[model samples]
Target chain A: MYKVKVYVTLKESVIDPAGAAATKEFKNSDYPEVEQVRVGKYIELTIGDTSKNVEEAVHDMCKNLLVNTEVEDYRFEIEEAAAK
Target chain B: MYKVKVYVTLKESVIDPAGAAATKEFKNSDYPEVEQVRVGKYIELTIGDTSKNVEEAVHDMCKNLLVNTEVEDYRFEIEEAAAK
Candidate 1:
């Protein structure tokens, strides 16, 4: 089995209002050094078998399902899982 | 400046509905090898200065604000930023 982790982050040109709000809240509380904050999505998946080309399948998923290319960028890492 | 990335994931015991839904959808569509799925939060923060102990502060933020210890596990990576 292969364990895959996909990270989807906003593009450099995009503005993250939610992250801005969180930063504002944090700065108001106790963390003033936090200059900028951006929130992204992390996805973890377990591939049941090696039947398919795992990397290619994961890349396809990221490009089509997991990411909004116009505003977000995504990358993934796949590793062999220890048997369970 | 320091660039910090915090990845928050669901604990082993916790059930992830969103991830399950996605996995089911994927399996139904074209990816049958997807066995399990989990969704998590990825936070990117740019710390403005070096006055603070970056590691300590990041850990504190993760413990107190970013992660809910009950159902989520979190980890962070911090690296010095190149002057831009």
Candidate 2:
């Protein structure tokens, strides 16, 4: 099996309210040592052994649904899954 | 600077509605190649150089806010940030 890890994050030009709130919350919670905080979506996909072009399939997945291209950017890492 | 990458995922026993929906959507979207999908949160934290124990501080942050121990599990990878 193949394991694909996808990270969907807001574009640098976009404002992230959730991230800003978390930063403020950390500062107020006595974690004044923090410099920055960013929050995003992490998705893991388990792909069954197949002959299909996995890379193209995943790229389409991200572009079509997993990510909002208008405001978010996404990247993925692929690896073989260890034997169960 | 220290860069911390945190992944917060639902416990195995917990049912993930968002994941289920995504799985169904994939199946219908001509991507029968998909097997399974799990969704979670990805967080990045930047910490300034300090005398405090970095690992301990991050652990506290995860336990106090980044994770919901009742339903989610979290793990972190820390590394030195690249010079900007």
Candidate 3:
């Protein structure tokens, strides 16, 4: 089995309103050191099958379902895991 | 500056409707191997000033603003970076 962790994040060129708001909020609060903030999605998957190429399958999943390519960029890491 | 990556995830006992739906969709689609899916928040922050304790500040941020402690678990990592 494979345990995969995927991160889908806004592109640097895309303005992140949520991040901006969070930054403002941080500044207003005690965290003035927080200069920039970017929020993204972290997806974890437990793939039961190991016969297929895990990386290829995960890449396809990201492209097809998890990520919006226009405004977001994504990356993933895979690790072998004991079946659960 | 410091580059901080925070991962906020639902507790194992909590139900994840979105993740369950995604898993169902994957089973119906090409990724039948996907047995389980868990979705979480990936937050990135660039802390400009390094004078204060970065980890302590981040912990406070997560506790006060970034995470809902009741149903979620949060962890963060910090790396020193060239001023940006």
Q: Report lDDT (CA) for all predictions.
A: 0.88, 0.88, 0.92
Ranking by TM-score: 3, 1, 2
Give the runs in model 1 whose Cα sits over 4 Å from its true position: none
TM-score of each: 0.94, 0.93, 0.97
Candidate 2 residues A1-84, lDDT tens each?
A: 789999998988898888889989988886877877889999988887778788888899899979999999999999988745
For residues B1-84, could you state the per-residue lDDT of candidate 2 as single tens digits? Answer: 798999999998999999999988888887766778899999989888878889999999999978998999999999987646
Clashing residue pairs for model 2 = none
The candidate that wins on TM-score is: 3
The parts of candidate 3 lying over 4 Å away from their true place are: none
RMSD of each: 1.3, 1.7, 1.0
Task: Residues B17-72, candidate 1: write the lDDT tens digits.
Answer: 99989888888878878888899999999888857788999988888888998999
Looking at model 3, the pairs that clash are: none
Candidate 3 accuracy as lDDT: 0.92
Per-residue lDDT over B8-37 for candidate 3, one digit per residue giving the tens place of the 0 to 100 score:
999999999989999999989988889999
lDDT of 1 by residue, A1-84 (tens): 899999999998899998989899788867888888899999998887767788899988888778899999999999998868
For model 3 chain A, where is the 10-residue window of minimal lDDT?
A49-58
